[model samples]
Target: MYSKFIINKDSFLGLAMNDIDKSSGNSLTTKYKNIVDSVLKEKFENNKYIDGSKIQSEWFPQVKCDIFLSHSHKDVKKAKQFAGWLKNKFGLEVFIDYNIWGNINDLLQNIDDTYCYDKLKGTYSYKKRNFTTSHVHMMLINALADMMDRTECLMFFETPNSIDLKKMTHSTESLTESPWIYNELFLSKILQNIQRRKKNELVKSQESVRLYADLNENFNPKYNVDISHLIDLSNDDLKNWLFHYKDNKHQNKPHSLDVLYNLKNINLK
Candidate 1:
């Protein structure tokens, strides 16, 4: 039995069998290899390049979620309240770190606290194998990447501290130097661009192709200015963007209550 299989444009079914064959007996490997080869040859002989756009469309034909709430660890309470409001009012599925990480945050907090204390006490030694810095960092990156992958729409919960830090910073470091919130924003923008590209490719028209090309010319994955401007918006304006009502005729009216009422009435499964 094949333990893992991943089909990509470059490798196809051969790569999957090769990967499994590395750890399997010759006879067992031969059995699965022949099966996979035969299946691929029979079913997918004409399909050379994997249709990434088609696969993406079939998997997420519509918006899988209403929002992905990205916020600082310090603002967990407020974020939770906002998430609860969105869910109760709009029946929207909001993805927050707490929902995904659960008790892992507590564990990581303890580990981080211990690490800091040890460093301050001059007892932190790299020779010790107790949750090294690299391990913890890798765990965080992997978890955040997974969560971000599942998010259909991303909303950053900006606070005073986040705004100040973002404004004060001016480096391109990916590690301890850059704030995690900023990294999350960068990653989200990159993911958004990728999804946009996939969706655009699915249009299958010369006009769409030209439009996509033009869009790419202006697409900056860094999104520094855009994010800063968004952070500077008032609560109502921010809410408008989140609810996608910026161009509505009632844009001048107060948005909070009205938006909530509208969402509450819209029946969403």
Candidate 2:
């Protein structure tokens, strides 16, 4: 169970940023390299049926993450900056899927070249390609679901790249071209809602303060997304949450999320 926070462009950009350098790009690239290496190793290591359990374990290792950041592929830079801010101020470890998932195409290409490519045709077999894609996508979806289940919070960076504002004759709606973003948003809304686990009950040892799109090609399909269920989070709420966390001393150790949940929603009517 996790809480979803919707932070629009304005609210996100307004937050006071720490002096985090642009080194996130290098680190993100290196992290992605490691994942690609691991994937290649798993494929070449031994000849055994790659079962669901092995795929889950090999493809998605248990990373310590307090917030699962959901956003467009284009917003990776902004997401990294935001992640740095969260870490600097709150000691939160964020798992940005872009660090790995953004390079999914490369992974797919490697796999296809090895197994799905037809040498004579100089192209991949349509059916074989589909089979490989479905398996990889299924693994990705399952990993995402498992990560969301383990994390305490999810923050979606709302931006033009991630969502399109559609105005009909009588109503307005938010639509996303990327099925991945749509899936993340849909899961965030429906995933089990539970309170943050206490420190003693947590499997991972608490480090510190507990916590915590893109465009298109030709055949893009738009998904109608509803973000009303997500709690609206603003810059003011972030500042206030910091204060609330600093002041709370009644409990042995307060959950950082409790302070956020207790705050009034300024965006809700």
Candidate 3:
């Protein structure tokens, strides 16, 4: 189950929540180096809601994807409700983990305020450089990232089940954060973002660059909608740039048959 809390504190008795946000941001800014420590591995233990799926129909015919929803059990009910919505909306078959979200009666049984507050005060692990709270958080984020990359699984926003969605809907208060989906499509999110990417990354070959450059020169409208504007990049030039290791092959790079197009057109110069 997944949920998110978007706290937009309006003028409650004339004092606004923005004041607190600014103060906290300023405090963090004063000690900016922590950004590296904090940002290095985003310790977000929230569920991820993905609006898109890389799971093509051919991948699974008999089984709908098995999604591993990881989050605090306090967030389970809302996740189930949302899962219901998802099932109704896309006719998607889903499986909710029992550990994170049990029945409502179980929720009532486990609603200890003291337990909630004390959850973070657990033991530290020198190996992981984490205490209980941070360790759990890091684990969740890593799991979420891995799931998002899967061709089938999708993680969704996670929040406590204590949140009242029906009341929230009726009140006309839009969730500012509103619990959006997170994807690693952007370069920063995956390789550089995670503690991964550099070693096994596919490098852009100079041949690919030359190919793009050459294609740009020989591009014609019959081959495309707007030939000049569309295929303006030469594949050959792109390939040359991409071929990292210099060799005898590029010694006498032939001038393109179609006169060298103005680099200024594509702003390449």
Candidate 4:
């Protein structure tokens, strides 16, 4: 099962993790890009009907992670800093979408230029681009959901960039301008909270679930987000968790996050 945490603005500020993070990020991004590129090339090698559904599994394969950081595109730098801080302080692997899937735009552009372009008119076909984008976005949404399901914790970096203060008149109601953020938050609220399986336990694979049937090329709908269920953690709460972690640093590094769960008495499994 996943535990959701909302990190308020200015909760923590520190230098990002050093070259280690940079190097690892570069390696992972390059590897992912290569894999995606190869998969696309292999699919197009023949003119036979291409099954986009089958390729979704090959694109953006899931990776083991400790925390999933969901934030606005504008807050990417802050998310990176927070991720680095988490890595340095707790040895946690933070999954920031851009870091791993930054080449999404490149992939879209490539598809549009190759299949959606009208060479005679020197322009891209709107309908063709729409079809390509829908498929790419669907694949990304599925991959993201899988990652969220696998991670132990999901943290949303809440700030003005991600949350619309004007619409938040009541404690229960929240709004966001981002469709991606809306989808992520919506999934967090509904996705089943499965208990973390032990190392030796055999995992069960379930059928893929698609919840965004209304998504489209012009996906600009306003979202009334429900974040009341997410546990609110301020700077002090993070500091308290950090203090507890340091006090018993000798515990297993991988399961160090259990300290925060125990502190909040939340069943994260």
lDDT of 3 at 90: 34
TM-score of each: 0.42, 0.78, 0.23, 0.78
lDDT of 2 by residue, 1-269 (tens): 45788888888555666456235433544564476457645743442334554663534453656788888989878788777777666666677767557666776677677778889989888788777767766666665666666778889888899988754545535888778877778777667665445332323221111100222255567788877777778878888887777787786756566667668532211
Q: How would you encode candidate 4's per-residue C-alpha lDDT over 6-95 as one tens digit per residue?
A: 988767644335666555554544554465556655544442335566654534444556788899889876666677667777787777
lDDT-best of 1 and 3 = 1
Q: For residues 1-269, what per-residue lDDT tens digits would candidate 3 score against the true structure?
A: 11111211121122222434444433422332233223222322122321123211121122222333332345544445444433432333343333211332232223222123344666433333223233333333333333323312223332323122322434532121111121111111232211111123322111100001112345521110111111222334323322322222676653221112222132111
Cα error of candidate 4 at position 9, Å = 1.1
Cα lDDT listed for each candidate: 0.40, 0.66, 0.27, 0.68
TM-score preference between candidates 1 and 2, better one: 2
Q: List runs of model 2 lying over 4 Å from the truth.
A: 21-53, 56-61, 166-173, 199-216, 246-253, 264-269
Candidates' RMSD to native: 20.6, 7.0, 25.1, 4.3
Where in model 1 is the C-alpha error above 4 Å? 1-65, 99-125, 129-131, 165-178, 194-269
Q: In terms of lDDT, which candidate is strongest?
A: 4
Candidate 4 segments whose C-alpha is farther than 4 A from its true place: 13-62, 166-168, 197-220, 249-254
Better candidate by lDDT, 3 or 4: 4
The candidate 1 region of ten consecutive residues with least summed lDDT is: 205-214
Clashing residue pairs in all predictions, respectively, total 0, 2, 40, 2
How well does candidate 3 match the true structure in TM-score terms? 0.23
